[model samples]
Target: MDIAATVIAIEFRLPGPININTAPAERLQELPGIGPALAARIVAFREEHGPFDTIEDLTHVPGIGPRTLDAVRDLITVVDER
Candidate 1:
């Protein structure tokens, strides 16, 4: 009798571009440079000021500078709640 081994592979994918307007800090942390603290700051900024008008507006968030924004720009998006 002979035994055979089988290997399984799994692939992971993001649902789509993260919606900055609605994504929570946990979700925001998925970005390349965003960590827990930065993610929370983003959420706080959004909550305090309102949803971002554009991806570029993320620069307004403390700790989120141009470099961080550039890293995540292609991966994030802003959606209109209204």
Candidate 2:
């Protein structure tokens, strides 16, 4: 067996209580159904529009819908402005 073939892939998990309005694309990718492109779109949408008021507001983002919202709802939150 080749030594290189023995390499193992490791998965890195992000710490939870992730703030969707403020998390970087990388961290956002850890959500249930979100990937790199969707994560970037979320950030772009947030920047172009504004912060999300409620988790359901995520459906306003182009690719996200009610299903995706339901999947990630528990994993994300909008940080309140104080």
Predicted model with the maximum TM-score: 1
Q: How many residue pairs clash in each candidate?
A: 0, 0
TM per candidate: 0.79, 0.76
Give the range of the ten consecutive residues with the poorest summed lDDT in model 2.
6-15
The lDDT of each candidate is 0.84, 0.85
> lDDT score, residue 29, model 1?
90
Model 2 per-residue lDDT tens digits across residues 1-82: 5555444322123345679899999999988889999999999999999999888889999899989998888888897433
List runs of model 2 lying over 4 Å from the truth.
1-14, 80-82
Q: Candidate 1 lDDT, tens digit per residue, 1-82? A: 2232222221123356889989989999999999999999999999999999999999998888889988998888897433
